[model samples]
Target: MLDSPLSARLEASERILVAGAGGGFDVYAGLPLALALRDQGKEVHLANLSFSRLESLDIDAWLDEDVAVIGPDTASRDWYFPERALARWLDAQGLPATVYAFPKVGVRPLRAAYARLIGRLGVDTIVLVDGGTDILMRGDEAGLGTPVEDMASLAAVHGLDLREKIVACLGFGVDAYHGVNHVQVLENLAALERDGAYLGAFSLSRATKPGALYLDAVAHARSEMPDYPSIVNGSIAAAVRGEFGDVRFTARTRGSELFINPLMALYFAVDLDGLARRSLYLERIEDTVLARQVAAVIAAYRDEIRPRPPKAFPH
Candidate 1:
């Protein structure tokens, strides 16, 4: 039997922070991992790069200039707030209700905010969770789906001087809507494996407790925000429940055909430092103060490079 490095890494840490790399319900994708860690007597916390307007939050809601503490009652005007909805679900389930939220700012402030949260929570380990594998893309990929926020989170966490730092990406092909090529995603993973940064992959099984809870949490979140359910998580949840091939739940997938297959339940893990080092453009945005600046840096890099032509997965 192969010993799992991902399990060993989690076992080595006492205080862990599992954060959503991309905004929205990306953090929900971490629910299973976080729950597993907690069951092992590790103190785990949840957070996200928020899609909600943090500015709308009352001054008291802020943990600092960049981090906000969002509980069940936290106020927000947005129709879609995955953080608060997740909080409510947690509260109802008798778990911790507070979900930390950070503005989708540039590397500079986002890094600072991450540092503050680590200090406040006394976190020794950080697991940056990306709902999709786009975070694994090196700049030259034919389609790096919505890399802005994902890269921002990766770059920001890379700046942290933590003892244990890892990244876990779920919902494999869910980023297709944003144009991520799965072939390029696999190629990047192989490269990371060469660098010894690939932590190994695991799949979620709805038959287990963590997997069942993940399905419940995702369903509860979707129920809480019926008007704007998360397509990424919805598809992941559907796949986890053993659904496949264009299975639709919400109207979010009305037109597009979806392949809700077993692969979507798989998680590809990697070490944050090696992953960050592999990035061709993260250094360019390290000094940025605004989120748009990070986007600009990526755009400039993309313009300068000749991306590999998109390749279809040859079955």
Candidate 2:
């Protein structure tokens, strides 16, 4: 039952890689979909552009120069290793706990890492899951939020040859704190729709099995890393559980007011190639070998363009 365009597109794929585009807890955004795919008897794998200190990992953990296989017992000194946290959670659930992680490198090395993973995993489809909508920012927005990791993942996957490439983003308005304008996100989606890139959106309800599992996974992660739980996933999980306005799931968002609405539970997906084509500065970062180089390129590009003024949603 291909209920949505995203599912329909993925229907033919046997091996799929759902990767975290913006690193950190971004891969958690793909959990529901990955679980649902597994339920449908498809082989789904998890990976992330890791924000952890990969340099501390043992040499045997390295699957490639920039890529490593994170497991439940992967030794790490970093307290905020989301990949290892997720691996532990998966292991507890008696699921495959091996998560492929890439160091925070630039597009060149990142792309090479992705290529190695795709080839080794025999992945026919790649879904880049972003925890927030910041990945949709096409370079000229008034605020780009955190575009470095997102754009790097986009550019890296854009260079890959695969049967299908998709981008799925959860946590719609959560990027407000980072200065992302939801109006601009909508405007960008409209543009993608015009380009035939928008795959439409869907909601994750707590009533469903995948949603229930997602909540459990998030709760486990929170318990494991109590000091540094993901604010983004916490907000989304709150929304999924029918919480509203300033829902306080974690102390991380203490000083800030959160608009925890049902919309945060919605997943907005698009064609990866279409998104890559839409990013005005994606090409400039293609040859980058270091994360800082990608940041510098984006900074220089932002300096040249007169950004579109941020607009409020006039409802």
Candidate 3:
């Protein structure tokens, strides 16, 4: 089962819902996973913040064939559909679904609606993607930068404690504004206590092929590369053991900077792997050390914010 492909994970879930910010990234990542679930006879729902100005597009044509080429308007950046619309659509469906959110998702009412979805599902897992991790770490554009506080609020509203929750941290991609990157933040994971609930991190490593690497080739062409970060396989192997113990915390093992929606799908894929190993539950409280680490980083950033002395002392 360790060598089983993503299809296996999708097949295992009775019902699945893929959610993320709409964009090329999501189409590339999340859509494939949702289609995989559908292929396996599992009820699947795909939801995202809209980014198309086409009013509405045909979903069937987009996923007509394996690795199909979707039209431009299906995920154009100019469009910004509200999350509430997706939530309403899901509520109407009346089926089990997992809502995934990415970094800097500030649509408050959408999140609230998702919390209600948790109650509706009763027994379901909520996967917070790498982008959401960014929001959790740096707070939002409004300067409300407390992840612990936010999680606490969500827990209270949902009547669930995070420490007991299966919180899977998708630990790849170097995109600072949306993904976890700072070394200090990564180091602090050692202190986190998800109670007995599983808290795991994953990072992909570059592949060893017979030719120049893809990232190197892109760099030579001066083309933009995706934000996903890479590490030595040994390092990832070690971190996996350290964080998850005997449990396997799966990573793509393919070096790719993932876009928003796909990143959410990857979160579910890995979470499914962990779930297969052992059942993970939500605890009322996570480790207090998370608070200490947050304070330390905030203080470090605060120091950076300190006013500097005048170039020359005043007379």
Off by over 4 Å in 2: none
Candidate 2's displacement at residue 136, Å, is 0.4
Model 1 lDDT, full chain set: 0.91
Show pairs that collide, candidate 2.
none
Scored against the true structure, residue 17 in model 1 reaches a CA lDDT of: 96
Please write out the lDDT profile of model 3 over residues 1-315, one tens digit for every residue.
Answer: 444433333334564545433222231223223443455675655434323342233444232211111232234233333232232333434432222222222223334444544444442433332222322232211222234333422332234322122223332322333323433233223323232222433222233220112223222212121232222211222332333222221253344432222222123223322322221111222222233443444444445543222132134
What is candidate 2's lDDT per residue for 115-163, written digit by digit as tens? 9998888999999999999999999998998999999999999999999
lDDT per residue for candidate 1 within 1-315, as digits (tens), equals 487888887777999999999998889989999988888899999999999998888999999889999999998887778999989988998999889999989999999999999999999999999998999998998888999999999999998899899999999999888888899899999999999999999899998888999999988987898988888888889999889999989996789999899999999999999999999999998899888999899999999999999888788
Q: What is the lDDT of residue 92 in candidate 2?
A: 90
RMSD of each candidate relative to the true structure: 0.9, 1.1, 14.5
Candidate 3 lDDT score at position 166: 27
Q: What is the lDDT of residue 174 in candidate 1?
A: 93
Using TM-score as the measure, name the better of candidate 2 and candidate 3: 2
